[model samples]
Target chain A: MDLANTSLRQLASALHERRISSRELAQAYLGRIERLDGELGAFITVDPEKTLAQADAADARIARGQAGPLTGIPIAHKDIFCTQGWLTTCGSRMLSNFVSPYDAHVIEKFAGAGALILGKTNMDEFAMGSSNETSHFGPVKNPWNLAKVPGGSSGGSAAAVAARLAPAATATDTGGSIRQPAALCGVSGIKPTYGLVSRYGMIAYASSLDQGGVIAPSAEDLGLVLNAMVGFDARDSTSIDRPAEDYTATLGKPLKGLRIGLPREYFSGGVSSDVAQAIDAALEVYDRLGAERVEVSLPHSALSVPVYYVLAPAEASSNLSRYDGVRYGHRAAQYADLNDMYERSRAEGFGPEVKRRILTGTYVLSRGYYDAYYLQAQRVRRLIVNDFREAFEQCDVIMGPSSPTVAFGFGEKTGDPVQMYLSDIFTISVNLAGLPGLSIPAGFGAAGLPVGLQLIGNYFSEGRLLQAAHGYQQATDWHRQVPDMARA
Target chain B: MALTDTDLKRLARLARLRLEESEITGLQGQFAGILGLIDQLQAVDTRGIEPLSHALDLGLRLREDLVTETDQRARFQSVAPQVEEGLYLVPKVIE
Candidate 1:
């Protein structure tokens, strides 16, 4: 059997039945990553010594009957999360040589659950760009089409999972970082309600909107992982104090009487015909499954991209101020004075996209522009949130296309920053509203590329969203489809 | 909303990013594209809407004033480009 294609659940069962040892499974995946990742560029760091060591620990636990569901399950993480002793680059040259001294709350949670860390995946620099081209390491290739970009800032995570380099990977969404890539690469990914997962040691992007999530092959796999990833940590001031939940409990629940809201604005222009057709087809399957589709309105939806560009960059400018050639990260090798060191270090370490965002962010929050840009964007953000609140009153969950188009060729949208920003228009409003959103592979779009159907749930409604996605996956074979590179 | 070279340079200085003189002209065009997109926010009617910083309605969560973390200066500073006596070294500001 091809161990690479096995789901987390199937792997768990195989390990429990003594059919495969954790070390053996780890070896197989490590070998595949070693051979295939050269072309895919899905990982930034993968150490066989460390991977096997973690698997050996899991094997010992399995022998002692102490294995958890995720024990021995190999997974990669976006480099955005700080992992102790690993090069947590955040896909930037700024931290390329900097090894983290600690683990993020998400890393700790997964480790505590006995999940084996295979390696760190690449990402957009500081999670800034819509495409992974901003990564200093080089852009990650879409597993389906090598020339196409795996949608980003979590592109590497999406690519890794989609290519079966690992069963799943942890990703962060500040805008559509998680969901858009998951859609573009044909993987299931979720960005939980803000504060559902702690950002304690995760590198800051846009703090208020940034939420750590998972990218996996199927919604069931995501549910299995989210169970271990959620909960509050006092270390993160923004972490929510919500009770624990069995995120997998609602999976396979009957879809009867389920209210799936179709946002009229989402179906309007901006979404390509191929993507729209795929989403409509997925809705038809849901309708057959006994779910009700109701028309809803998110009037302020069109403003999401502009609002996100303003607010995310503004927060990023403040958060990134910490990287001023002191403490750690990149420092200028030569400088005339203190100010020169600060400026040179940032200019040298950051890529063009990162500098662009920092400049835009600075412009918005500047002395005279604050009210006209930053404050206005914030107020518009409130209107977007209110629109979602009103729409939720009419439906149980919102559904739409996850990205405006399927994965495009590298440099296709790079010339025009506005064109790049528009790619995320479908997925950004969910983040602006602080609602939990999931993207699941629905069907193939243009050029036989995969398309995703997005499900946006009210705050703390992750279980319901997973259940709805899971119900759809059971009736379809899309989630079961793997890219040719991953097939054998 | 049209960003001139002077405006771009000033913004870059405030952002603490040192862009080369040659790179500024190219950046000016890119910045113009982004600004043109975001400028649409100004046309939005937000008179009664309050600006939201956080997505949730909850206020700041406070904790007791107690020591929760132990010092790990050595471990934390291991990755620093330059360090002495646990202090991060940089071009002198005191002088």
Candidate 2:
């Protein structure tokens, strides 16, 4: 079997049986990275020395018969998570030289699990843009079609997994960053309910909407990694205190009697016909599995994009205030005054999209405009959440297309920021409602690019969500298709 | 609502972003487009709806007031753009 093609679970078993050494596995993935990463641009940082050192440590643990299921498995992380002693540039020049002094909670958790840090993948600067084009590191191309964008801000993670550069990679979703990219790149990704995963040291995007998740080739793979990734940390005040669960436990359960809601707003205009057909075909698979499909209405779902733009930026402008010239970020060499230094430094540090969001944020929160824009958006957010609440009452989980369309060519939507923002319309509401949402590869659409079927469950319903996704995945081979880059 | 040049300047200052003269026209257009898209919020009558601050309504988690971290200022300051004697340096405020 191809080492890169193996699943995280299969790799774990192989490592446990001494069929492969961790160092050898790391070297194999490193070789693949060195060969394909130049064209793909998936990773921002890949340290062979650090990766081998971690693998050697895992080998020692395995030698002592103390190996966990994830021991010796290599996983990439989105650059948004702070990794100690590694360049954690969240795809922005502001942090281009900033090596993290500590590990993010997600990074620390993976380390404790004995999983080797393969590398850090590129992302939209500060998780700001839907397409990876906004990255200071340069755009991460789609693995399936190099001319098209790999959906972002988790584009690098999604592309890496799609191309089999890594078995799995850590991602964060605030306004569909994880799910939309996964859809475009044809991978499985899950954004747990807010507070389910500790956000400590994961750079804030939209505070309330941001949640760390995983992108891999299959739901079973996502479940296996999420099992080790979720927990409460006192360090993060928003971390939820919940009993640990084996997310893979319900994977084998049948989908009989499962009620999946089809939101009317999702199928309306904006979704391409090809994507709609793929989603419809996916629902048919569920129907064949004895699952009941119920039509539900989320009338206010159409407003999620508007509400997200307001609230996410409002929080981002505040959260990003810490990146001043005085602190650990970019600073101008010449400045006449303190305020000029702050202004010029930020002006030079942030990208166009980031700067736009910050200005929009500042404008919305400014004295006279606060009530009209920020407060109004917040109230509408409640209405969107209410729509989901009412919809869930009619069904067990909500189903829809992850993205309105498949991956578009580079620079297609970048010209129009509103157009770029609308690409996330389908997945944004899940973040707004703080629900567990998953995107699984259902089938191909335009140009044979993958289409993702989204599964949204009520708060803390990750087990049910994963079970339903796994059920669908087992019945279809869409999740099994790999880009030629990996096969080559 | 259309944003005037004065309004854009005020927003730039509030955001602490220094916009080059060349960036103004483009930014104004982009900001207008975004604001126009966000104007959709105005169509919804949210008079009785309460603004949601969080997705989950969980109460603030309280913890004992204690120093749980070691002093890593030296390590932290190592990455600062300008640091002197373990202090982060900025442009002088006093003459």
Tens-digit lDDT string for candidate 1 (A168-282) = 8999998989999999999999999999999988999888899999999999999999999998998898888978999999997899999999889998787889999999999
Runs of candidate 2 exceeding 4 Å displacement: none
Candidate 2: residue pairs that collide: none
TM-score of each: 0.99, 0.99
Residue range A177-224, candidate 2, lDDT tens digits: 999999999999999999988999999878989999999999999999
Best by DockQ: 2
Q: Which stretches of candidate 1 lie over 4 Å from their true place?
A: none
Candidate 2 is graded, for docking, as: high
